[model samples]
Target chain A: MGCVRRSERIVRLTRHLVDHPGTALSLTEMAEHYGVAKSSLSEDLAIIRSVFEQDGNGFLRTQLGANGGILFEVDVSTTREQEIMAEILAQLSDPQRILTGGYMFITDVLSQPQILRNVGKMFAKLFAKEEPDVILTVETKGIPLAVITSEYLNIPYVVARRDHNWSEGPSVSTNYVSSFDRRIQSMSLSRRSIVQGARVLILDDFMKAGGTIKGMIALMEEFSATVVGTGVFMATAEPSEKFISSYRSLVTLAHMDEMSGSVVVEPGNYFTERM
Target chain B: MGCVRRSERIVRLTRHLVDHPGTALSLTEMAEHYGVAKSSLSEDLAIIRSVFEQDGNGFLRTQLGANGGILFEVDVSTTREQEIMAEILAQLSDPQRILTGGYMFITDVLSQPQILRNVGKMFAKLFAKEEPDVILTVETKGIPLAVITSEYLNIPYVVARRDHNWSEGPSVSTNYVSSFDRRIQSMSLSRRSIVQGARVLILDDFMKAGGTIKGMIALMEEFSATVVGTGVFMATAEPSEKFISSYRSLVTLAHMDEMSGSVVVEPGNYFTERM
Candidate 1:
């Protein structure tokens, strides 16, 4: 540790910060790990932090003293966000992605590790202030998004299933109208999935009438939990009046016509409107 | 770029390598990015590679020649694998995790990001030789696992749903028996999810009679996908003759009694059996 090269120390420091996002670490302890002077460690941290900020990757937070420590939270910069938005818009522009119903095929896009990895960090930064204890998303499409977002937020995620499985133990059930056909459908969450009085964030792939999100909100109420926020990958622009309010979407489905099978999409409220 | 310090160069190089895992980049271009001499860049990469190898996180593979560039693949070290396995076994040993049916509750466990991150890399390493073009899994429990594994392998993942959603466009369907209740259940994948003759790796959270995996295998056939390998988080030991073979699990469910409400588990076949 005493004779470690400068480059060696920098690589290890970078890896550690990337891995333990949102966790604060003492600089003195880090210096001891590499047998370096405290001043040298601080200098290294400053260089890493400056690079991250300049690159728009994310910045590091360092505090002074015994209780104070250094922390790094991976972020989605404005440039990065625009890149993701462009990707989503470009993909949505393809008419073939439009499906039989209101559903547009996005499984391919969401399944890409890099896409999800970036989008997850975006959601994490967007909602990091909520400080929720857990994230909740109905199963199938939202699972991967929730998993990655939870990782960035450093929390566990619970998935509600359309049907109850006894193996998951007792569950709390709620019925809601389906956005697809307006049919009444019910979803359930395992009773043990969330603790009472916990803060929760709800996320999903798409929102048409907000029926599913409404149902999840009600389910959260049953557990005496607070719904800090509701997030969606995209939302239909036609349904200006949704079943529930107080939600944010990453992209706006400006138009989609089942009659002519046409679709138009734009960036969501999460993105700044271009002049 | 010319005045970049050694720490700055090292940090940027490390971040770039970690970001573009599995992608080959020319040393000459990388050297130009920093306006550094090729020799200096090589020294930086060697330092990064040594640290990663020493920490057992992963290693960098640098090939000589212009066509043959440098590549990095994030991997789960043997020590990391054992740590993940240990966590799985300890969590599975809890009596309260026992559910009404054969299902020992694992939703909470799988929801953790760090655990899934490591477990995903383990699956990636175990099946890297298969070089699957895509990873496939049924809905609900397996989505997160599939998503993580797909990322580690730098491949896409396709999920089969329990029911057909028309908005996803036309989909091919197949019926198979589920292990949960030995009930005949059906699943479907979007017609566009996978291409014909693609090498596929099937993954899941748990397997008992191996019925669900079998169903997935059948579903893959309809897609004209090649089943390269099957991987599960846990498998029941008593199912001496499973619905299918040729699968590797991360842990072994030595015993679970619904009537007695007891649960016992051990490390899976992937680990060397203790004498």
Candidate 2:
């Protein structure tokens, strides 16, 4: 087939693979669909898989056995996670999402389920060795991915609320400086929420100054729960001391030159280190 | 063995079975653990299985042939997803969570991974017939269960944000009156977020006036996507005319008498209805 025809076929196959995850299609089937030889289809798949891996979305797993074909598995690495996070931070850093008071429009970041799943999977892979008893996050945005990670690990999760909830038993409160507001706010968790002696993995959507993680660490300490690891979806590269040293981040925002509309995003260290 | 000894053996076996999900313990192994006869262990297992099934969690499927023993298979219908939802709604209706504001505290409701998993499993059963293409939810709280349900169904999900996101491209926005604040807010979705002809299932953590659901429906219409189903974790009975009709709820809050500290919660019709 011509180059143009091959490119079109690759795009069609990519869409099909994405649309039908876990199901593999044989080279013969692809060849039949494209009215091409099996050898031609193999070459096309090789090019498509290479492009897909380069794009950092996922990879195509090929099998040659009877009843085996090719399947697309979303194997996100720490570096890719960081790349995605940098992209997210770049989006957040955009003046459009920034409110007058310097608050980021986080509603978009919190709403996307696919992003949450990606982040959760990244965390699961990073902390797989930890074998945490549960995933924990503060109420609201972090709840989505915390729950997802917890599900991935087959563990329960608890959320810490910012305010005092009467329904919850006596809670342990700690002061944490909010990165968005730059003001110290009280974060609280019910004493009954965290299981004693349980290993907890803390996850958050965005961490600029790492104050929230600090407070969570304090709460976990109060409950005698060990903090197995910490994971964040995105972090800012500025204010070098803002992020804690031990934590893993999927993406780091290097900088965004608003004047030039130039946002630089790259894969983070976690992606490279984990996957 | 004496009756007390046999009872102790049964209790120990039951605990072991609960701890090891789906693993079948052979009679010889059980006898070795309890230092009892194989016949006695078999009898104890039979009794434990019967009691467990009576309690309605699941059954212990026992195979009598060689290399067979007792394996636990959870009975999906026995626990009655509706009963679980009612319990969750009752927990949410705590006056402590409501405080002075009419708005209920639901952040904790979204954080519980087990509850979210159960909710997802319930929705999977409810929408088993439809097999929705994507799970849809508005931002924040709804994202958790929506992610879980999407994972359960193995389908992609789209979230409608309250504001237009430039990164998401030109989004369609719909005005939704907030049930708690009574303020009209716009929920927007990128034009590219959802498939045009896909069947979408909308999910939310809580439904009071259902304004958000209505906005979601409008958003789906804009994309020319079919709204296959709508489900909520909890719904208030007070809201007679919600934003949409033909929606399903796991639990309905019938009443909460703050003065008496009495809360009335019941399973919604969605639990028993066919998908």
Best by lDDT: 1
Model 1's i-RMS, to one decimal, reads 2.0
DockQ measured for candidate 2: 0.09
lDDT (Cα, tens digit) per residue for candidate 1, span B43-70: 7788899998988777787657656788
lDDT for each residue of candidate 1 in A202-239, tens digit (9 for 90 to 100): 99988888999999999999999999988888888867
Number of the top candidate by TM-score? 1
Off by over 4 Å in 1: A1-4, A26-32, A62-69, A258-261, A273-275, B1-4, B26-28, B62-69, B258-261, B273-275
**Each prediction's whole-model lDDT (CA):** 0.83, 0.68
Residue B139 Cα positional deviation in candidate 1, in Å, after optimal superposition: 0.7
After superposition, which runs of candidate 2 have C-alpha atoms over 4 Å from their true positions?
Answer: A1-122, A128-134, A138-141, A159-200, A208-228, A236-240, A251-267, A271-275, B1-110, B163-171, B195-198, B222-224
At residue B244, candidate 2 shows an lDDT of 77
Write model 2 residue lDDT over A68-149, tens digit each, in one string: 8997654465466556576565655555553333334454555454555566656765786686877889865677768777
Give candidate 2's root-mean-square deviation (CA, Å): 19.1
